[model samples]
Target: MDKSWIDWADWCSKPYRAKLEDFLNFAYVNRDPSSRIYCPCRKCENRKFFEKVIVRQHLHGNGFWKKYKIWDKHGESRDGADSLHRDEMFMGSDDYMEEDMVKVLNGWTDKSFKDLLDICNESMPEGVNLPNSYYQAQKLTEDLGFTYNTVDACPNSCMLFRNEDINLDQCLICKASRWKEDGCSLVSDLGPGKRKAAKQARYFPLKPRLQRLFMSSKIATLMRWHAEKRTDDGVFRHPADSLAWKDFDKKHPSFSGDIRNVRLGLASDGFNPFRTMNIVHSTWPVILVPYNLPPMMLMKQPFIYLSVLIDGPKGPGDKIDVYLQPLIEELKELWDEGIETFDASSNQMFQMHAALLWTINDFPAYANLSGWNTKGEYACPSCNSETASIWLPNGKKFSYGSSRRFLPYDHKYRKDPRSFNGLREYRRSPTTLSGVDLLTQLQSNGILTEYRREDLQTRQMMGLEKPEKDPLKKRKHNWKKKSIFFELPYWKDNLIRHNLDVMHIEKNVCDNVLETILGVAGKSKDNISSRRDLELMGIREQYHVKRRESGSEYFDPADFEMNNDGKDKFLIALSETRMPDGSASHIARRVRLKDRSISGLKSHDNHILLQQLIPLSIRSSLPKKVVEGLIDLGKFFKVLCSKLNCAADLEEARSRIVVTLCDLEKIFPPSFFDVMEHLPIHLVQEALIAGAVQFRWMYPIERCGE
Candidate 1:
């Protein structure tokens, strides 16, 4: 990606800029096929336009407090500068969140972010008037402090999703937009829908040489900007919460040196819980590349596997640099190539997109890189719309379902009433998670587990219902109609709440122990305090008081041992004793001091005692949280059962307890040995270790050697 190609207008304005203009024109001419050319700046004569407006009867829309502005280094508006996005409880937000976060964290009605975006992006009312361009949208945000933009179906039937101060128009100076006799080409609109889907057209009419232009920096930048969301309402509208955005940014890092390092970018609008987005010059990433880039040339449409770069101010977890490393490197490489590389920068031709695939090679202990359905296993987007597996584009027969969506391929099951628009669209071409990212995914889930143990007490509280038993099962409860308030999807997501069951989910990196009588007695490698046992690990220096009085020095093991003050050993001199882990056996009878000095001690004195350093396995932390949480959780079912109305569901709920107790035992050591006999085998140990963090999550490409 040559730097010269970056500011396309810079060269186009100069008549004699032959070499630069010639190459860029060749790359840009007739290239983009998605009909996404920059649109006309001046609103002139009327032309063909397709528009949509859907009315939403006023529902219980909960209102939020205020929204703040995100500013850049130059003091430009980031998003909604001085305005606020009122948080609505009912209608959408309620369905996605729990009662605790809604009422406790930030008081509101109830709703999910997904549903909120759907409502926010709905067709605008006919009478509402608004600004019509991207910069205008920007200006509206800066001056008016609030804004909204619209999408038109000019030449297409689908609704055009719009935003208030986002990408509504093309860059007027640059060739980001175009003008025509009847209507202007919208190729340049920076809207998420057009830019994200534009890459697909490039592949439709492929060629041998054209591929280089396709691989140009311009294309790379386009992809970088296009990666807006991890999933759900990422296309537009702010995200509902910080947890959702965190998951998004984890996938998209801010930067990397290689392709394998690519992850997803996390983005959200309204009030971001992360707070980074609301500050000055802070950025975030999201990983959600549905497919690779190759298919765009052949298929002529959007495929996943495209990462994006977003300059924050629009939402939380904003900015898209994590996906820009490759593009930036390619540009610098071209700059070094002098005149030979032909200024085909990311702006002109090679713009790229970045995203993170859900399942990669490193995460095999969980699932594959997502595929289509056979039923019962994978999520059928057309059936139940819970997790990300629904839109599995990397599989053999890639497809997407509309409305209650599901792909028609193999490996997943689909049921009605649950699935919705699973096969949303074709992922980027040849899409599959691999290279460096596959390894990173495994490392986070794997090696991280080696360090900390999560207290999953939440799961046992009956707060966590088992992860939906296959999307195919659409059984609804008659209890709600019979007088109960409502039926929850998880009834209780014990596994989600405290995650007491996932004891090793957290990691303990170090351990240290100390005794007054036996100074610096011992330390374990795993203990962070082990260094403290050596004295002040994070500190720079320490002083030894007795050393100065000794005059000869404590460095000499003989002098250091046996009472530096020249008195008899504190433990020795025929002292009283205390029962310990046998180490107290060293208490009397003229014993040598803590330090071993060959010349002054018997053979046993030289032997280092292992008892001082106590090692705790990761699994040891598991049983307590899981067991305790579950024990408390069981009472809820008992109470529900005793109520006389939940006999049937409570009866079935019996198995949940057995399964929970059994899982807890597998990862955690039981308080008793034969106690396992009284319980079911599900609670029995098949192996000492039920699950090991996969290598990829803990160790990916860049970290292979480290």
Candidate 2:
């Protein structure tokens, strides 16, 4: 041993004999002080013989002491050099860590990282250290191909505070502060004009995430499955195999030429994440789903990439175009210029082209993105034909209160031709204009105007559409003539840009159905006219019981007898219900189905009513045709919720629903065809034409929200 090593041993033994003994044990050293063992540590590298002194220097070296302290702190037996062997000290740690990781992965949003760490720490024994800090845990997760890219956003929610806007003092549109002016969100002191980032939005990019998908051999194989694995024997194995997708490909051959290229569907909706209806805060998250994967895995939350988040107190509404600027620019680059991307499965680099196949959103979001007012006189986006709406007494809003005529205008329900009073007109436009023509007509001065003459001319034909009554009245009739959609390099056709989401349409229609059924509105099931009709069907029960001083029934409506089985089920669903607090029941009162008064039903309650209860309770009481229509509607939704194999199945289901709803026009009250209800029928028809599969349904997202 060297003389310096001997001196170092003498120095360590004077102050740290206990530590030296621990180190000697950790290095598996012999007891004899003179005995020579080869030093296998990285510093000495086996060239130098290990004496007690040399081992002490190596363990106590400035570079090694910090980790040695950690070893000591954790009651670790091995020295820093033997870290790989530290696994022995951490016996059962892998299993424990894996269990913790599952909680992090599954319910990430449920608890903050610090809270998760605190909980984990609480479970561990005293002196037992965790594997990583919260930030280190996040870094480790990122290394595992899951993480977020956060970017600062404008406080006003006008745009993402990045690129050119990064240096901007205030938002150009809303003129809101770019930083926390009051120093509330800042960590450091802000003096006068100085500021810190006030608001931030998490953005997960498509490129790296898509590359990560390719990294997994299983997913990479599935990504190419749409083109290679699918059978092309006149069956809908994929959306590309459907007629609508094929037609689009035929129209734009260049886009469809590369079968390996990815196709994506964009969906966004403003939802109150706070979960309180009274507080109107909406958060719009834009999700991009790769349709290249199989149906079963396509819409999974983990698989779907979040492209952007539009923070909101109020939803961006039509101004959503402003916030979508970054995404649109990136999409344009992906489409026109393409990006150099590597496929880990194939082990090759290629120029990747991604196409935005279609946007899926509700009517309001559709109007915002597509620049067509969904609440216009011609509310039907597919046809752009005249629509009939009636002013509701209770709602205080005009609802499309008549059955929409199909494009051909051949309908027995049309009671008026020139007047178009009871009959909704079906004047489908001669043709849908290309995006180029639309842009030319809209942006006459190189900037999007509030309204287009062509659109106004079409609206002129509708009697309800006066100069003052243009539906863009919400924007004071200043509807942006051009939308961000017009700028999409790939979409030359406007008709196909926005897809009608079946989910939102169904929910809205279902809500209306529930309101109508529960007597929540005057135009609904409990209406005087409908009650009279129900009473005629031998379905009368007592209601509006005005108790006299003698407690005798006065002004009783139940003049007819009720059927046993139907009345029993109907009464069970509606007769007496627990109060909101669940403390007591509203006394079991005998009430007619038509005279039922109930409110505050949740979305799932509506689902239960539509899926199982409605048909069972209402069938025996209403007219035969009305009963049949309601049963058919319920059956259709249940069928949709079942296993569907192909696009043909969707088309068949849509056709049956349309026919069933059309047949009920005379049977149901006019309010049943309110715009909310009318919209879904057309949306389903459009989805059938577009060849949407079950994976693209909005129900999944809404269910996720819940």
Say which candidate scores most in TM-score: 2
List candidate 1 segments past 4 Å from native. Answer: 1-282, 287-306, 311-706
Per-residue alpha-carbon lDDT of candidate 2 for residues 469-514, written as tens digits (9 for 90 to 100): 6444444222434676656765765336777765556655666664
- The Cα RMSD of model 1 versus the native structure comes to 29.5
Could you give candidate 1's per-residue lDDT for residues 201-309 as a string of tens digits? 0011111112333334555333333243223332211111123233334443442222211222111112233445455542222222222122122112232222222
**lDDT, model 2:** 0.57
Q: Give candidate 2's total backbone clashes.
A: 0
| Position 387, candidate 1: lDDT | 19
* TM-score to true structure, per model: 0.18, 0.66
- Candidate 1 has a TM-score of 0.18
